[model samples]
Target: MKLTSKGRYAVMALVDLARFDNINPVSLRDISLRQGISLDYLEQIFSKLKKNEIVKSIRGTQGGYVLNKNPNDIKLTNIFNAVDEKVKTVQCRKESKKGCNGKATKCITHNLWDELETHINTFFENKSLKDLLNNNKETRV
Candidate 1:
């Protein structure tokens, strides 16, 4: 699956929020600046995240966005899937007999597509935001 810029920025925004308390929201400006994303774009992406229940928004002087769940409870797959629904690698796929159009068996490398999708799902599902933090240290930042 190919993640669009929206998906990538959404993940980055979430990771930034993960560093702070859930009760405390982070301003869109701050997130945009830190992630090098445009504030307007982050605002749009955040609205979708809020709709998905992946984030909670607050309105006030301290208004901003925060995660709805513990970072550990939020799987990377959730973030990924929330922003990008095109989770399959296969393009123009189909099936015939088993309702399989030209998309599935029509391709000479059907198994490869299936295997790749499975691997991608497995990798993301097993990963969490905490894993990202625990594994990385001394980042360029």
Candidate 2:
């Protein structure tokens, strides 16, 4: 399964925010510049994130955004779900008799892809923003 820019950018933007938001709220423009993401696109992503309560906006002259929960509390799956990103591998539903290959039964590799998708999703579920932050720090050293 291919991850769209919305899913990738949302993670990048949040990582940037997590790095600096402790000092103050982070502006979408700042994250846009730092992450090389479009300001308008970030706005759209943030709107969904806000709606999902993944983040909260501060309104004022110094207004911006802050995470609704701690970094450790925010899993990659949570970010993905908040942005309506699906980690789907197969094109067809497993429950449905219709197959992705247009045949009566699923292709030989269908179970393989489905199992991989489950593992990938589980990895994301186990990983938190705090884990990413720590990994970043380790890589820098």
Candidate 3:
């Protein structure tokens, strides 16, 4: 189960925003340059973010984006959900009767993969932008 660039880039961009947005709103162009992500892509990601109310857009010469809530209050899971990102380890849906191998029963590893997905999602649920920023500061020091 690999995460797509959409999920990873959204996290990276938000981390960058959390780092500098306290000074002023952060522009996607600036985040794009620093994160080496395309501006167009950031715009797309931010559109979803804005719609989800995770961020608010500003207007004018210094117009940009800012977090709608505190960094500590914004969990990674929230960002992933806002961007329609899913952490799926199994090919089949959990509620579906079908198996991952398209057989009568689930594959031997299906339970293992499902458990792993739960762990991964729980980790993200427990992590917030503040945790990431604090971890960065600790590593730098």
Candidate 4:
């Protein structure tokens, strides 16, 4: 399964948020400049983030966005869901009863794909923004 730019960008943006959380209410413009993401794209992404309660917005010239929860409490899966990014390894929608073959019967490889999806979700669920920060620290050192 390949992670699309949406998922990657959401994670990157959140990582940026976590990095500057001490400063609180980080502006999208600042994140755009630092991360090289487009301001328009960030607005769309932040809209979803805010709706999911992953982020909170502040008003005023000094206002921007801030994490609603601790970085350690925010998992990759949460970010992914916030952006409507599904961890799909197969063409078929797992939520549907029909299979990839356009039949009601399950595909022979359905179980395989389903298991892989579970593993992927589990990996992301176990990882938090804090993990990303710690890993970055190790790499920099």
lDDT of each: 0.77, 0.90, 0.91, 0.90
- Which pairs of residues clash in candidate 4, taking residues 3 or more apart in a chain or in different chains? none
Give the per-residue lDDT of model 2 (tens digit) for 1-141. 478888899898889999998899999889999999999999999999899888999988888999899999999999999898998777788677787778987788988998999999999999999999999999975
Predicted model with the maximum lDDT: 3
**Model 2 TM-score, all chains together:** 0.87
Candidate 3 C-alpha lDDT tens digits along 1-141: 578899899999999999998889888989999999999999999999999888999988898999999999999999999999988777788677787667888898888987999999999999999999999989975
lDDT of 1 by residue, 3-74 (tens): 688777887888888886554788998888888999988888888788888998889898888788877888
Estimated TM-score for each candidate? 0.82, 0.87, 0.88, 0.90
User: How well does candidate 4 score on lDDT at residue 37?
Assistant: 96
| Candidate 3 ranges with C-alpha deviation above 4 Å | none
Candidate 3 residue-wise lDDT at 1: 50
Clashing pairs in 1: 93-103, 94-101, 94-103, 94-104, 95-100, 95-101, 96-100, 96-101
Could you report the Cα RMSD, in angstroms, for every candidate shown? Answer: 2.9, 1.9, 1.8, 1.8
lDDT-wise, the better of 1 and 2 is 2
Worst 10 residues of 3 by lDDT: 93-102
Candidate 4 total steric clashes: 0
